[model samples]
Target: MNEPDVAVDEALPAPRPMPHGLDPDGLTVGVEEEFLLVNARTRRVASQAPSVLAAAADRLPGLRPELTRFQLEVATATCRTAEELHRQLRTARGTLTAVAREHGLRLAATGSPVLGRVTPPPLTDHPRYEALIGQYGALADALSLCGYHVHVGMPGREYAVQVSNHLRPWLPVLLAISANSPFWDERDTGHASWRYLLWSRWPSAGPPPRFASPAHYDSAVRTLLHTGAALDAGMTYWDIRLSAVHPTIEVRVCDAPATVDEALLLALLTRALVATALAATEPAPAIPQHALRAALWRSARDGLEGMGVDAVEREVLPMRELTQRLVEHARPALEATGDLAVCTELLDAVLRRNSGAARQRRAFCRRQRLTDVVDLLTAQTAGATALT
Candidate 1:
């Protein structure tokens, strides 16, 4: 697939006609992935991120820490297309993996793992994190979890807010696609994304209400902060939200996908969804907040193995059919971005091979050891497939 035209400020030598009805100049892409560090021998959560970062300080530029010492995050610079995102994903994962291996640690890109056991490592020594530890206590401590967030550029705040509202119903399908966390605390949680469950423990986490405008969105965020439901604007942890810092709509529904392919797939589809929402002339459907919550739970519980909520119908559908519906919904934007063929191929690949959760379970069944799942995730995180 051709990379999306990323040149924003300067004119191209020759402008190509935008295909498939996408606003070629309007949409850009960025991704943030959080990964867990585990001891190489024991496959347990390792508080060695600091050491790894210190060792590779000059090598990995975007590498940084998460809430816990066991987690590390890498953010990709804004890019123009799926191809660029794929390349960035490979470089980030490969560099991080090499650095961790030097420290006798392994990097696994899943939502949550059994390695943390009863408790995760201590919080990072940041003052803001210190405040979270003091306020949220165990809720903050047990957060050895990680997620992949996709950001799609919006024209402005209004479009970002509207796109966020329109994209709500589709969030579950995306969640099911990237559901990589099935085991937690050394036991199978039976849910595809145990990370989502762990994350929702925070008062400010979950789906955001439909906003009339960007001002309404700002007001809602202020309410959460004033009531102490959130520590700050950054903690608004909606499954999807207009980003607080960047000028993009960010989707936080996915687990830290187990492979670079799956991570790029998530970013491609997310950009398509945002583009589709922006092109829509009609208002987004009004599914009740309760129904939306139920839909999210259904996606987390069944993933691609069973039925998922049909957000519009407020009922259930086989995940296979639900995924196809999503593809069809985003077809135009995918084609416009030159990602339709790759996205369709990847979607078929995911269905045929099964979700990361299913694959992890299969690995565990083969060995009857939870650490096998950890090993599998560790290996898969390192550029599972080469990008053409």
Candidate 2:
């Protein structure tokens, strides 16, 4: 297969000269998390997003509709610290869960709707989403998978693009740490993040190729748009891309986390990853396209449970060992941002409990019930229980 389009469009004004390390003001971070809304009684996905949004609008200021009616997104304002991001996510999840309950719905941060109902919920009434449904046909319906996008500030577009080139090899590592979607269509998909596998079917979705410069990245994006492969620059849904709406490198590799702490851990790791890339003298060389895709597939398939491709070494290693190396690689950045301890603790907890995929599977195994799995996810999403 040909290489996936790794184009990232410039979202900022003309670049201004700036020194590279951590930005003097510090790298800001923001998180966008999407959730599935399911009926409280039937546990079926509920197409009640509009109604839920209206009811919760006052309580949740930045709530937004997703491609499907069964999904809702909550994004936090930019923050300078992980603590702030954690607090905001907690509040957003709590408020949304409460409002959803009022409407007899449950919010699940897990990857897919738990039960096996085949008919997809209706698409949201929006021109963009409508255009997608028309263009992609059945592929559009699979867009119901939820994801977590973490935006980390970079000094400028050139810097962001440079970081992106350097960031590619590490993308699989990030994906493994955040994999939480194991079940889809009410059955274990066998892959840790079936959401990623489903989403990758998009023409523009997957790890981007290494770029020579920001101009090269922008040109590639324009080329893709001209071909109608993507509706717009925003459709360049590479695992990591320059944000079309913000001055940040958006990491879109992970499933929407099941809890606030998981979300925060992802944010911390993302910022650290970007910072480490910026400070580096050289980024990893472009892996062969085949290798890049294989690494990503392994991450989505096994998550922490299987072997992972060590893009840096170009060899596969135990996923647990690979993740530990990722933390060490980003340690300098974590320390600079005062997040080292918290990040370490959170990563440890995730490994201990296994990724969200493991926990969801365990719940089903123990009770032999999908509702029990849904219950576990809802409780975690609302922060009513710890990650374990």
Candidates' C-alpha lDDT:
0.83, 0.84
lDDT of 1 by residue, 192-249 (tens): 9888878887888887776666777888888789898889999999988888888888
Q: Quote each prediction's TM-score.
A: 0.92, 0.93
What lDDT would candidate 2 get against the real structure?
A: 0.84
Cα lDDT tens digits, model 2, 1-388, are: 2333442332223223448444732789898999999899888888899999999888887899888888899899999987788889989999999999999999999777787463554889989988887787888868888999989887788888877777788888888887888887878888998989998999889988677567778877877798888999989989889998888899898888888888899888888888777776744465766788899999999998789999756798999999888899898888877899999999899988888888988999997999899889999988889987
By lDDT, the best candidate is 2
Candidate 2 global TM-score: 0.93
- Clash pairs, model 1 backbone: 4-81, 114-186
Please report the candidate that would top TM-score against the real structure: 2
Error of 2 at 64 (Å): 0.7
C-alpha positional error of residue 80 in candidate 2 after TM-score superposition, expressed in Å: 0.3
